[model samples]
Target chain A: MPREITAFSNPLVKRVQALREKRHRREEGLFLAEGLRILTEARETGRVPRFLFFAAASAAHPLVRALVHAVEAAGGEAVETTPAILSKLSGKDNPQAVVGVFDQFETRLDQLDRGAASIFLVAERLRDPGNLGTILRTGDAVGAGGLILVGDCVDPFSVEAVRASMGALFTVPIVRTGWEEFLAWLRGGPGQLVGLSLQTEHDYRAVAYAAPTFLLTGNEAQGLPDDYEAACDLLVKLPMLGKADSLNAAVATAVMAYEVLARHR
Target chain B: MPREITAFSNPLVKRVQALREKRHRREEGLFLAEGLRILTEARETGRVPRFLFFAAASAAHPLVRALVHAVEAAGGEAVETTPAILSKLSGKDNPQAVVGVFDQFETRLDQLDRGAASIFLVAERLRDPGNLGTILRTGDAVGAGGLILVGDCVDPFSVEAVRASMGALFTVPIVRTGWEEFLAWLRGGPGQLVGLSLQTEHDYRAVAYAAPTFLLTGNEAQGLPDDYEAACDLLVKLPMLGKADSLNAAVATAVMAYEVLARHR
Candidate 1:
């Protein structure tokens, strides 16, 4: 039997709602992920949420039951709540039937096995949570090892980013560090640092990407700094035949990632 | 001298603010675009706004002055307004210094010159305005002739879509029509209908793409319908190396567009 909470004023409901904010998530060391599919993905990835909240209507769902079982087995609480409370937790008029609170995965550059995958993605000062999530999905699609964030970036654990990732957040490892530290780690590893730059005349397709290629993209607006570009082992530019000077940050990263994937294949 | 509008209650301000809504934009046959760079792009592309609003503080900016000159030369109204009024109009706390009202471009499949560019993009039932705008930007970056929207789709003129396009909406010709109509029009021309499908065993890169390749993608959640996939001249699937079964609709389109571009180059 699961715990029941119907009131919006319930303490657990308030705690779960707070996970929507970055500061709250960081303080609690827990993040919210909604929908059965995402929670199933988390389970498949050997992650059990600390708390599982499901609407009473979804109690009979086999997937939901499986999730409830997993939560119980893991000594986590399973709560049966009203749709109104679920809506309050998700901040959406039409909320998912299920929402889960999971501990944040702390990833480090030193822990990453560069030899595990042929490609990796690095973003510098990425500000958009949606873009960060889209990049994570692209990383998953291309089978890249993980995504690395250098400098200030929007929280990957934000609800907006987690939603945008479409569950890639669980599948892809994310690392947050400074530029100097990231460069130092790359220097220590056997990886080709390729910077996507506008200054270079070298076409993105014209180059032969070496193994363990690390594709680096810059901020949505400012792009990579001069010294950062200078440190790259190679610089490439995507063709922009139209009047628009550049593609969206996430779109550019996807294009480059696919190009690298093709070469590796 | 430009007209001065410091009152938020002004009818003109209300009218401009109404453009943010899809129904109002359709009824008025107008749309809003913000930022000096985007407005300049519109001007360069030979499309002048019917009304240009600039903050009093930004009136002296060289770009703003140039825009004012262009609007005045074209018999368009240039209004000097307060930042608060601009914010009210744009619905952004930190609104751009300038915003413009322009007539929506009426585009049709018959008007598109498919031979003008070797690549084109088609999206089916794209629900997200942001994804629609990003696709337009991708179309511009790859020099696609245009983007064709099939079935019920979000308004390209929505402020969210327009902003996300980053002025690509001005450059890329967008056609909205039913799927059957689009197929009939596409079949009448010398082009290849290549769809991004999960059903296909053909790797996206393995195919020898013909000239005038029309890259088609499905909706964000459901993907392409069976009949739509069957109708394609060539069906291609992007590699999903990780657990994610699909990429973000816009990101997938960008990846495919770049591949077609590479082959054409």
Candidate 2:
């Protein structure tokens, strides 16, 4: 039987709650993935957490019961906890039956394989967490190699973003860097650096994306920095047939990513 | 000079607040559009509301000053009110400089022109307000004729959905009906009835959409009801390459919409 934790103030609970903060996540090198399906995805993707938790009342539920034993079998701690304790740690009025805590993972710019033979996404100064997460999901759906979070992009691991990603969070690798570093990484060696912009005269469909593609998208409000646009080998635009000037950032990125990847395939 | 509304409890304020609720919107036949760009789109698209309101301080802003004249010139009312009044009516701490309340426009299925010569979308039992709105935006981007809200979809005029739509609400025609009625309408007379489903073996791109297309999409979680799936003239699926079984509903719809429309154009 897994040990039951009733006290909300337990140190382990405090540590898990602290992981919600990005600074603490970075400092402790841990982040939380909640709900049963996502935790299962984490485990299946070989990104299982160091610790797992389940509400004591739900321990008998087949999936939770099975996951608990699996966690224990894999040398990770699995605890059964009271609803209040789980609620406090998960920051929900009613917490999920299960939660998993995994270490933050990233690939350094220098670590990217030059001839890896896969598409990658670069989001320039992206802000909306939902957009970032949807972009990640699109990247995964198209079998992109990874994502490069350029400049001050929103945190992809934020709860809202993770939920938007729908388990793609575990499957796709992400790299984060400032403008200078990203440009240097691009210059060194990779794939075709293409930018999607509204100001461009070229239609998106006109561009051939057969070469290993690095599809970069602009921020919602400001778009790609001028210097970064200069660095891109091609800049393309989606047609806007109506009064609205542009589609939502995530929608535009999805169109670009799917189109580019679809052509190459 | 437009009348000033300083008291939050004023009858007009109460009425405007009531518009936020679907029941009240249905009862009063009105909905709101906020923010500068969307309001501008509303004006340009000839969707200028019966009533437009501006915060008193911004009444002097060039765009607001111009819009005030344009509204009156176009036989509409424009009111200038205090910031608190605008904030309360708009339901935001920092509300947009202006807000417009327009009629809830819904065309009856029988009223649709028999050979209108345009594409249409059918969202079957979609629940997410954001997804519904994004679908509207995509529909507008592709010059779709209208949308059919079959079964129990979210209210398209709800604030969150309207924001997601990014002003496409004004340009697109919409019709609402029960599943049986929708089926009856689909069979009566329109165009090719195409359905998108993961269950289908056919790839979406391989299907030709050169004819007037009525694309039927399913709910985010449960997807199209099995009965509706049987009703589709043809079924196709988007390619999913990674572990995630599906893409966000709006993203998937956009991919399909762009692809079909691109082929025709």
Best by the lDDT measure: 1
Question: What TM-score do all the candidates reach, one by one?
Answer: 0.98, 0.91
- Residue-by-residue lDDT tens digits, candidate 1, B157-249: 999899999999999999999999999999897999999999989999888999899999999999999999999999999999989788999
Residue-pair clashes per candidate: 0, 0
Off by over 4 Å in 2: A5-29, A70-95, B6-11, B70-93
Q: Write the per-residue lDDT of candidate 2 for residues A46-156, one digit (tens) a residue.
A: 776778888878888887877887788878888888888777777889798888887788888887764664688888888888888888898889887788898888887
Q: lDDT of all the models against the reference?
A: 0.93, 0.82
- Shift of residue A99 alpha carbon in model 1, Å: 1.4
How well is each residue in B52-97 modelled by candidate 2, as lDDT tens digits?
Answer: 8898889888878777777888787888887787888788898999
TM-score of chain A of each: 0.98, 0.91
Candidate DockQ values, in order, are 0.89, 0.66
Best by DockQ: 1
Taking all chains together, the TM-score of candidate 1 against the true structure is 0.98
